[model samples]
Target: MKMLRIISYAGLVAVAIMLLVAMCAILEDSVISHRAHRQELTGSTLSSPGLDHFS
Candidate 1:
């Protein structure tokens, strides 16, 4: 029983770490895109808009 309890706790910790990693990745992507947008505004880069209002 003690071993099973320890295993369960370890599993939960692994899941929590995975979730944190995923969240960090998403945040990093957003930050990178925001920086790119700034460059675009300054004419250092160009990218097409992803969507239009008419659709």
Candidate 2:
């Protein structure tokens, strides 16, 4: 009985760790994509004809 209980606790802990790692990876990817999108928007606006008139 004790061995079974230990195994159950270990499995739960392993699952928790895996979930935490997955969440971190997802968050990192989201942040990188957001930064890239912002850069893309800025690049487009900078190339607009109106901005060229200012130069």
How many clashes (backbone atoms < 3 Å, residues ≥3 apart in a chain or on different chains) does model 2 have?
A: 0
Q: Which candidate's TM-score is highest?
A: 2
Best by lDDT: 1
TM-score of 1: 0.75
Per-residue lDDT tens digits of candidate 1, residues 1-55?
9999999999999999999999999988987878677767778655446632211
Q: What value of lDDT does candidate 2 attain over all alpha carbons?
A: 0.76
After superposition, the stretches of candidate 2 with alpha carbons farther than 4 Å from their true spots are 44-55
Which 10 consecutive residues of model 2 have the lowest summed lDDT?
A: 46-55
